[model samples]
Target: MSDDPLPFLDGPWRLSMGLRRLEPDDWLRVDDAHDAQMRLRDRLLAERRAEVAAALPGSEAGCAETLALLLEFLPERFPERWTRDGQVMVDRRNGRRVALDGEPPLVIAGRLVQEDLCLMRKGPDGYELSAAVLCFPSHWRLAEKLGRPMAGIHAPVPAFGERLGPTVDRFMAGLDADRPVWRVNWSITETDELFLPGDRAQRAFDPAEPVGSGLFLRLERQTLRRLPQSGDILFTIHTSVRPLGDAIVRPDHAAALAARIREMPERMSRYKGFHLMGMPLLAWLDRLAAAQVRVAAPG
Candidate 1:
């Protein structure tokens, strides 16, 4: 079995909530790619503000509370890189001092961390997407999802309404402020570009290039925490990508991933663009798995 903690690596990939309790200190993650990702976020916020950030009329209080919670949590979680001085928060990694006022609170919060921040508030129907600063959406648009409820926002995802909708709603409804949770979702793509707001039909893999050369494994680590004051769930998505070639180093992992790709439901395969990958990708994975097995066998 692979030593990787990522659930998807284990394989026969299935869609489920799969949420785990999140330690308060581990709320935000910072890594080597922080500088580059932050720069991209800054550019998007400045150039594509309307596309990346939005809030409903009455979501101001929730937005402000979300920002306040982050301001208190970030410095405490990552003291070395993040420090707050009154309304000005300093990021030592890029030497950027962010003023916590004037601009929308969600926008300011998005600039401080790698995760795209989203606020979900309880409405008559259910939890609605009240506000968000979604800089790196995988294949969806922030504009389309804004002001939408849980089920409505995920309407495009196949079987989501029938299979996972009610469970997600119940979980969101009962989520406690002190106890937060996190889960992961993954996808395969041909590009490493993070800003993907277009439809899945736009994805195309070149036939000439080697199957493994440009393939990428994209993972989104999502966290949901109910704010103590506003009772709004602060949803955060931290996206990371790795070269597919680098992910299948171990024989077991390679085999598991291959089985996952092969066994994925038809609709999901098409939804995730695995059908576009076609036989070439599967053949490549089989070869990689066999090679890894040979290399790992007893000398």
Candidate 2:
């Protein structure tokens, strides 16, 4: 229903990376919620900086390079919303001016855009998370992942080790500096809060309870490019949350989402907390699909 394309509505719900080639200009995104999300990022940086950001000892160069790349990219990508005058870049959305000084360069870069910036550098074992300014983590802590290799960082994700670990490592190691790629992932949550760092305990939902109205569809638009100067991969995640009700207004979308949810593996369902909603969520979606079909039927 929204103007933005809904990937979740076009899904069969399998566990795969689903990566696509990305244009250099589309690395970062801005939307109507930019100002509000930027305000939230500012609050998180001020109040919970340690929790949302971390940099290993040797990561300063990569972090600085990431910042410099963003400084060059932002104004060129969206000149109407971003302007650079000397060391200061002004964000027209919120009228916030960010300078090259003060906070760590990666932190400054995070402040300038909605995407959480992360640097992954190759270590003795493989690529490790070297530095990151992650304010809108879905349910993972930045501190726990810092200085960890790809497998260790993704250990919590179900089937990641068995299914995609080696593939991911190979992809990251082989990623070209000029050829960046991107992927998207979706999650269902009870709230629309952006700064979620801790996992929610599994809760029970009654079969008769209404599960559609209050839920949110959280989307992560993730991009990966190797930083030319640092030789470290720059990973960016731009998170967007929208009401589930608003996303499934069309009959086809509602049916497609319901089918995807039904086809999801049990382990993944539990991992994604879909087990919390149980059958009620599916039933609600089915009803919506039927209602939409009737409304769209010819007279």
The local distance difference test score of each candidate is 0.85, 0.85
Q: How many residue pairs clash in each candidate?
A: 0, 0
Which 10 successive residues of model 1 have the least lDDT summed? 1-10
Candidate 1, position 78, lDDT: 89
Cα lDDT tens digits for candidate 2, 174-264: 9999999988888888889998889875678667644665788888888999988889999989898878887667777778888888888
Relative to the true structure, candidate 1 reaches a TM of 0.94
Native-structure RMSD, model 2: 2.0
* Tens-digit lDDT track of model 1 for 183-237: 8877878888899998866445666677665788888889999988888999999
Instruction: Point out where model 2 deviates above 4 Å.
Output: 1-4, 9-11, 206-209, 292-299
